[model samples]
Target: MSHHATPVPRHRAPAQPTTDYDVIIIGAGSAGLSAALALGRCLRRVLVCDGGPPRNAPSPGVQSFFTRDGIKPAELLRVGLAQLEPYETVEVRRAQVQRVKPAGRTFTVEAEGKSGRTFTATARKLLLATGVEDELPPVPGMRDLWGRGVLHCPYCHGWEVRNQPLAVYGQGKIVTGMALLVSRWAPDLVVCTDGPGHLSDNARRRLRQQKIKVNEEPISHLEGTAGGQLRNIVFQSGEKLARHALFVHPHQHQRSTLAEQLGCRLTSKGAVWINKHSQTSISGLYAAGDTTSGPQKALLAAAEGMEAAIAIHETLTREECPK
Candidate 1:
């Protein structure tokens, strides 16, 4: 299977012919590829730099997509490529962006491939569709069951694990919101935090009314089977809580450093800051998807990407017109 990862070392490949383009997309994910398609449909020459490092590769299939719900991840990419194949002005390269710097009039990108290859390209405008990654708990046996039974998004995995024994694992302050919402999916839901979280009196009462147990012990380990399917959670107080699925509130980080490197302001939570119109602090730079400030989900990312593309089109059009 083809794979993508953040290149630890700068791997340089055989040099290829270099050229400029109307716009350069730094990722080929759901958002990045969608933006490239929209711009290309507008007759804008576009090139997408994606070493195929999609953040959702771990997902078995993409559900709740409205039109293409239940489509497998790799299948979705294949279909997207097929649709864009007729667009002669568009090109996709399997390269990961290492660094991006603005030149006198264009943006320069250095991308490294896993096969020890490096690529350089230029574009008039830059699109940051790089998504985010989840930060799991420090406890052992978590990564093995990460995407299988330990999930983060309720919209994605809620229905699958619905009505089962579920637990919400979070830090001192992160589990409350998820606990309240996940209660609807599973009747036997519990909130497990590092300690008795700073829950308001009202929240505490509401949780008790729902019969959801609240535990204050620090987590010892997220116990699970050998093949990555979660089973139970172990507590520091020598308690093993049987659970079928776990909802974790993972700390998130932006996948691409290019935005921060280009002076894109970040929210307190480290997500890229964008205006209501999806425009970032940087004039020509735009960000969307999970990288920006919002609830991270498949549909949300798609919508944000489209909205940002609209703002980008407007700005570039205004720039092209003589004031």
Candidate 2:
């Protein structure tokens, strides 16, 4: 099986790649779409290519953005796209960028449309806002529950499942801290190590003091409804712990290898490395959102995209359209 499934893409044909754009943004999530908006406002030629579903597509609603709080993820994108309608310089295509490489001062991107037709485009600057895919632990039904009853960030999902029976699925020192953080909303909490006992004495003591139960047994599977609503965690020893919600620190990797193929440096944590302006190690190439090494949130991604767009616009204007 594939490591993870990408989110579904919107239905659209690849835009004719006849003209070289000022900027090509390789994601249509908050980051890519926001960058397109900012660049479009500057009257720059922009192309946004959405390969697949956004990272939060499975979630019921987005959080933490002012005014947009609790808005559905797809709805947020719809609104953003509608706002870009008046910008004639901006174009969006539902295509997967399969490869990217520098060509002179510009970059060439090769993409394929939904109909399996291939197209090539060039950009003076490229933005790799392609987000990461969460790698859930290998337990039956775990993937199905993700973004539903099973989640990662407490800040994003804690309020919804607050005061419910929650469990933290992980192991080792970091997970101990994760358990503590999740306990803020889940007064009745449990930590399942899912393997060997690695929690230090102090961590165990802290969990005990907080009245959190720790289970060291490895998980066999999760029992849940067909719709992915988690109900219970089954252990190797045949014990079952009923839980209304679960939180885990899922390992993530970039959904696309375009950055890696183009020689962009990545952090030790597997995120694209970026500078102050959100530019990656490669010049004229930038990245933002969950792909970059930082706090991952929808609002933060949009802000980063705007920042990167402003920087890119300034640089392009100074070089190409200066007085």
Candidate 3:
């Protein structure tokens, strides 16, 4: 691959003016930043718009990432930003994307800065890595202790609370599956259904085999320690079940509407649908990370971003240099 320089405009007065950037990546989390790095190294003019803190901002530390395990989420992003400074072709802006308008082969993106100033920039290709947002249960203290005592991925935080009294919150087959998965880390596990545990006979039998107890009492609220760790699950009848941590698979949705606005195909689970090459239904548009259906992890998201970059580069190369 050959590297060529493309002059980028320092500023544009028009609300929506085309830029020299070959790619415009929205959301500067792991996936977006990784793609920007790869594209920048290719000497492609790229603009990465960061939409503030990532979804993992509430988590105390990032887990399972190579050489960066247990590092704070914010710190991990800080390191990523520092490393991108050397890539002059990549410009990262602290702005939230508000709108995306596809014009033939290019896209015009409208964004609002921290100062509330709105500007627009256009690129030949656009990548959406805006991630997703988790919607927790309505029970009290759930939000307060989220990412601390309350978590979603056992692979990410299970070891931190291993061998401790744990609880999985949900009903039906989902909770049963989560309980079984969580049992790998701790022996003292229980399922809190908040009401009726709609489990099949086989599911109940499986739970009994694993020695995991089931609590079907309606929950009043969750109790947490001053340090933000979960202490107990309070039932409506005033009974409290001591627990150190809670695992849940909350419903999630895309953090940005750009994909929908651009009419990209979506999965039944509400994730942006992509082909093997990370291209969406739209020819010049792409998606990666939690924005698409699959296991959501920092390592996986970064790898997807790298793959999307390679695909985009190859496509661009084909278009610019005809055989």
Clashes in each model (backbone N, CA, C under 3 Å)? 5, 1, 0
> For model 1, which pairs clash?
12-116, 12-117, 12-118, 13-117, 13-118
- Local error of candidate 1 at residue 136 (angstroms): 0.8
Q: Which stretches of candidate 3 lie over 4 Å from their true place?
A: 1-18
Q: What is the full ranking by TM-score, best candidate first? A: 3, 2, 1
Candidate 2: the clashing residue pairs are 7-53
- Candidates by lDDT, descending order: 3, 2, 1
149-175 per-residue lDDT for model 1 (tens digits):
788878888888899999988744457
TM-score per candidate, chains pooled: 0.87, 0.92, 0.94
Q: What lDDT, from 0 to 1, does candidate 2 have?
A: 0.90
lDDT of 3 by residue, 1-323 (tens): 98888888665333423466899999999999999989999998999999999999999899999999999999989998998899999999999999998887788999998889999998988999999999999999999999998999999999999999999999999999999999999899999999998999999999999999999999999999877799999999999999999999999989998898888999999999999999999998999899999999998999999999999999887767545
Question: lDDT (0-100) at residue 269 of candidate 3?
Answer: 92
**Candidate No. with top TM-score:** 3
